[model samples]
Target: MCKNMKELQTVSERIFSLEQKKAQKKKEMDELEKEIKMLKNETSSYMKKRQKNELNIAGFTILFTAFARSSFDKDAFIAGESNGAELYRKYSKEIPMERVTVKVAK
Candidate 1:
């Protein structure tokens, strides 16, 4: 019983240490992400001002282009069309999934 308790205590301490490290790394990552976003905005602005779509420098190519994406409105289609609901049910398939998570208390 004493040995088991010691093992549990060791595992719990390891989990706490890992959680602290994870939090520190997350903070560093957030700062880096912010800097990257600022740099990208500056580069994009420069490209747009020069009326350029692509820039090749230091063996890297950056593309700044405009595009349109098409998306279907399921609810609107179902309301507007007579056979929309049936078509949606016929095309859509439900898949079973299992997710596992571990949460440490602060």
Candidate 2:
């Protein structure tokens, strides 16, 4: 038990100080959580943009290759180089390709 008025006042002041500190810490934690959410949203937006750009590039490359094959002579196109040997375009063959796509829920 606090004997004097001064001792009771000191104890009350300490309790008030601790409450203030706890509130301050809670506020800081909320701000940090808000920042993290904002950053995650920004990251998702950037990833979508990057995926769109990559698909555009791939489409352009395929179109360019097809256009080149149709417009130019087969002898002029270099097909592949292996072991210091240069190979020219001879024929076209269809190869199976696997593609994966990601869809986001609204």
Candidate 3:
């Protein structure tokens, strides 16, 4: 009977320790989520304020890229393009505006 009691106490202590660890992890996750939500909200607001370019315009078309050897994150440009649209959409919109044909030799 005494041996059994000792075993039970040991297990209870382990279980309690595990529960505390789990609670701490949960608290950390909640904090991270809150921070991300705040940042996303701020970025989204910027997107809303500006009128995204639906159609490409001749004057608006970049016309030509400097083509200088510089590396920038392509992903960021596509998502938050000049007028706030993808390269494909921006090019298509140019038809109505008769965009200036610029050679991109790179």
Candidate 4:
């Protein structure tokens, strides 16, 4: 029983340490993403001012392209079809999934 208890404690400690590391990494990633977004905006504005669609710097090529995105109009589809809801439900499927959540308790 003593050995089992020690093993359980070790596992718990490892989980707590991993959770703390995950949190710290997440914070770092968030900060990096913000910096990246700011740099991208600045670069885009500079490119626009110079009227350049593409740029090659340090062996990296960046291209700014404009395109249209088409999205389904749910309301329009439902209005146009007599049994839109039924059809939508028929095409949709429920996917079963499982997840494990770990946290460090304060």
Candidate 5:
């Protein structure tokens, strides 16, 4: 019948449209995967906190910053506050072998 033929045609068109949409999504996902892999190589990752130098503590939460630097106490990183940030508790007096910096995450 003509009616049956039309119905079959309509169903075929819908299936083709769905397949097109699925392919588009697959392409988008593949592009995103490539982008993520690229970013991973273009960045630095730290497994644990580490110091930048022997005299500086690198890992400190920067709540605030000002025109100031921490002065050495007894030739060691004792309790020192930077700008309005809290005085980070130093892990050891061995010239800060590890440093960590914290950022406020919204």
Candidate 6:
């Protein structure tokens, strides 16, 4: 028990100190949450930019392939004694593919 006024003052001071500490900690947590939110926004923006770029690249690849096929003889292009022919022969084999799609909610 706090027997004297000095002891009572000490207890009050301790409670005030603890409350200040708690407020400081709460402020720090709020700041950290704000930083995390900003980072998530930046990351989401970058991911959207990357997806757009990938779609553009896929479109260009399809257009280029169609143009090449129309402009050149397919058999000659694939079987010619050229570096491109060798690359096509080396890397053109089909492989099974799987992809996962992510949809963001509005």
Q: Name the top TM-score candidate.
A: 4
**Model 5 residue-pair collision total:** 7
Off by over 4 Å in 1: 1-3, 68-78, 81-106
Q: How much lDDT does each candidate structure score?
A: 0.67, 0.52, 0.52, 0.65, 0.47, 0.55
Stretch of 10 with least lDDT, candidate 1: 97-106
Candidates ranked by TM-score: 4, 1, 6, 3, 2, 5
**lDDT per residue as tens, model 2, 1-106:** 8999999999999999999999999999999989866765554455455553223332332111111222334554554646222333234334432222333322
The backbone clash count of each candidate, in order, is 0, 0, 1, 0, 7, 0
Top candidate on lDDT is: 1
Q: Sort all candidates by lDDT, best to worst.
A: 1, 4, 6, 2, 3, 5
lDDT of 3 by residue, 8-36 (tens): 89988999999999999999999998986
Model 5 alpha-carbon drift over 4 Å, by segment: 1-3, 45-106
Better of 1 and 3 by lDDT: 1
| Pairs of residues clashing in candidate 6 | none
The list of candidate 3 runs beyond 4 A from truth reads: 1-3, 52-106
Which window of ten consecutive residues has the lowest lDDT sum in model 3?
93-102
Worst 10 residues of 4 by lDDT: 97-106
For residues 8-94, could you state the per-residue lDDT of candidate 4 as single tens digits?
899889999999999999999999989877777777667768877766666666665443443454544564588887766655555
Clashes in predicted model 1? 0
For candidate 5, give the lDDT.
0.47
TM-score of 2: 0.43
The TM-score of candidate 4 is: 0.60
Clashing pairs in 2: none
TM-score, each model?
0.58, 0.43, 0.44, 0.60, 0.40, 0.46
> Candidate 4 lDDT (Cα, whole model)?
0.65
- Per-residue lDDT tens digits for candidate 1, residues 1-106, read 3379889899889999999999999999999989877777777677768887766666666767644444454544564568877766665555532222222322
* Range of the 10 consecutive residues with the lowest summed lDDT in candidate 6: 61-70
